[model samples]
Target: MRDTGYSLRNAGCSLLPVRWGLFAVAILILAAPVAASGPTNPPNPTTVILVVGAPGQDEFGRVFAESARLWLQACEKGHAQSIAIG
Candidate 1:
């Protein structure tokens, strides 16, 4: 009598499910190439320059206000000088 135990049942291997999982992962992995091909260069970026005065509590406001007043006085005088020069 032959004892065809459970060893015979496990001898043959099926690659269908493994192949499907690999195919799904392969499809997911291949999208990176398409993404890489699209955008070779990016658009130009915008820039802005801001002059923000300090808040009152930090003593920045007082110094800034004094500097601004001096600048205004100089500008006013500069305008008069320009007119005289012309």
Candidate 2:
């Protein structure tokens, strides 16, 4: 009968779990700073640009109009200090 129990190959595989645990800990430590900080709001005095295609042209004009309307709402909500509509 051969001594097949606790071979060197099996010993090497046993270290896999420890290596993965250490890797997980390192990742959490590196991500601590980003996780601690909450979401950040955009800077004040933001300039909002609304570019629109020429009206009364085609279906694209309708899309541009809708986009412009949404941007106007954002601007009114204090999301931007000024808007340049073109």
Candidate 3:
């Protein structure tokens, strides 16, 4: 029961657990607005277009077809949504 001035049990302690608890509560209250302040508008979905044309010097159209297939795969994944071809 010695007065070390830092114990929560000491009524005269300047740094009590209650004081620390209040400090933490005050910090959380002040930070609540910041934590809740995200983008008011959510992200808009994206659109992508894949245009496949004649590969001038290619013996076959494999390159163009492969590129288009990759684009389709991207759309299938969550990375892309609406897609069109021209």
Candidate 4:
């Protein structure tokens, strides 16, 4: 039975498989879903309307900004969903 300083140092370090180490932790984190644990806030209901005449441009803008702002108060609103005139 030999008790050596090398054995003591080796005991302090990791001898188990590398996969069972920090790599496994990272794999678990990446594999986990990003969504929250509880029920989600629900996606905002966005509306898109195609415009033709010039008069409706103003109206479309108003409706898009208003409804989108109203329904999805805390959510991120996209300009593309709001208004587009052609």
Candidate 5:
């Protein structure tokens, strides 16, 4: 082969800048999701699901019912939707 002064070592050195540029682009692309995932307030009101387990005793049942009522009141004040399940 003619000595054209080109070898594998020099070939890799010449491509160093291109490799670094590709790496930088890849890093930016990977970070895009993380940047876009930042917190933002929703446009609509929130929804709350209030679940009251089985109150085995009469006293427990009254307390559970009272708790549910309080939650419903708070939901109304906040303009949120509340679903209660027993």
Candidate 6:
């Protein structure tokens, strides 16, 4: 057989270290859940501040009011505090 300067043994040897490194990383990723299984505090509620701009026309004012109402409804649904300012 002609020596092609490339063989399975040489390729496998070069990749062995990389394979081991990847295996170690996989092990760490799998173990993260176990490390995170500790007592945790509940997160604080979020507050949303909705600012309505001055509408140039009556129609724009109505639209802004409706938008604010919708945002208030969503905040209530999400159990978040909301402050609406025009």
lDDT of 6 by residue, 4-83 (tens): 99876877667778899999999999999988897775664799999999999999999999999999999999888999
Q: What is each predicted model's overall lDDT from 0 to 1? A: 0.59, 0.79, 0.74, 0.57, 0.91, 0.90
TM agreement with the true structure for every prediction: 0.29, 0.47, 0.49, 0.25, 0.49, 0.50
User: Number of the top candidate by lDDT?
Assistant: 5
- Count of steric clashes across candidates, in order: 0, 0, 0, 0, 0, 0
> Which scores greater on TM-score, model 5 or model 6?
6
- Candidate 2: give the clashing pairs: none
Error of 1 at 19 (Å): 99
Clashes of 4: 0
Tell me the spans in candidate 3 whose CA falls farther than 4 Å from its real position: 1-11, 27-44, 57-60
Question: Clashes in model 3: which pairs?
Answer: none
Off by over 4 Å in 4: 1-3, 8-20, 29-41, 54-86
Candidate 6: deviation at residue 41, Å? 8.8
- Residue 35 lDDT in model 5? 94
Query: Looking at model 4, which ten-residue stretch has the lowest summed lDDT?
Result: 73-82
Q: Over all chains combined, what TM-score does candidate 3 have?
A: 0.49
Report residue 60 deviation for candidate 5 (angstroms). Answer: 0.5
Candidate 2, which segments miss by more than 4 Å at Cα?
1-13, 44-46, 49-74, 83-86
Give the Cα error of residue 20 in candidate 3, in Å.
2.5
Compared with the true structure, what per-residue lDDT tens digits does model 1 show for residues 1-86? Answer: 79767553387866778889999999979997897789665543422223445566758777766666665566565442211110
Across residues 1-86, which tens digit of lDDT does each residue of candidate 5 receive? 68999886777657678899999999999999989999877865689999999999999999999999999999999989999888
C-alpha root-mean-square deviation, each candidate? 14.9, 8.5, 6.6, 10.5, 5.9, 8.5
Which residue segments of model 1 deviate by more than 4 Å?
1-52, 80-86
Writing each residue's lDDT as its tens digit, candidate 2 over 1-86 gives 88869775677657678889999999999999998997888578677777675777778788887878877888879767656557
- lDDT, residue 79, candidate 1: 48
- Model 5's alpha-carbon lDDT is 0.91
Alpha-carbon runs more than 4 Å astray in model 5: 1-43
Off by over 4 Å in 6: 1-43
